[model samples]
Target: MKNSRSKPFVIGISGGSGSGKSTIINEIVERLGPEKIAVLHHDAYYRHRPELSFEERTIINFDHPDSLETKLLMKHLVQLISGEKVEVPIYDFPQHLRNSKTKKISPCQILIVDGILVLNDSQLCELMD
Candidate 1:
């Protein structure tokens, strides 16, 4: 007996590099049915550097949190809670910046965000509260 009224129970799945985060995400979607789930990749939130030259964007190590546009990510998460569609930025790891185009995400019964560094931010942890 699960609570069916909760709108999109957000589950943050994280692990070290090469971990099974993607596998777990797929499993959740499979068990719950695609209609009940939506997956968001943290990689889509990497910081943008429209000011930086191509060379500068390429040399940075993107594994750290600084490389991510977390503030924007946090904002969109809040918007989705209100059942609004959001435009999630697309990031290029090798380039170390967000792509020119964005991805559109709609609200679902369950939103599962999967990535290596997911839920590492204190602000994000508080948002769940």
Candidate 2:
């Protein structure tokens, strides 16, 4: 069913690496029904460094907020909230690079932004409900 509200109810989930963030998200999605929710993972927004070699990318601290394109994520969130669809980037963990293809995500009743740094950024926090 389509969301009747003008904006989705945004929820931000954050935790350390290896934490149960994804687990929690999965459970929530299951209970709430995936068809009524949209999930955006911060890890999927890691900055694409095509110029850097695989070795160099590996050395970079993936945990650091600078390693992600938070600005783009924020923009996408805005678009989603505005009842627009977004093309989410696909990141390859093994190669430490963004995949050529993107996943199209539609706005839904609930928007779950999952990542360790989701709550770290003040601007991002402001966007959450």
Per-candidate TM-scores read 0.86, 0.95
**TM-score for predicted model 1 compared with the true structure:** 0.86
**Candidate number of the best TM-score:** 2
Highest lDDT scorer: 2
Error of 1 at 49 (Å): 1.1
Error of 2 at 101 (Å): 0.4
Model 1 Cα lDDT, one tens digit per residue, 14-42 = 89877888888887777878877767787
lDDT, candidate 2, 40-121, per-residue tens: 9999999999899988999999889999999999999999999899999999999999999999999989999999899999
True-structure lDDT of candidate 1: 0.76
C-alpha local distance difference test of each model: 0.76, 0.95
125: Cα error in model 2, Å:
0.4
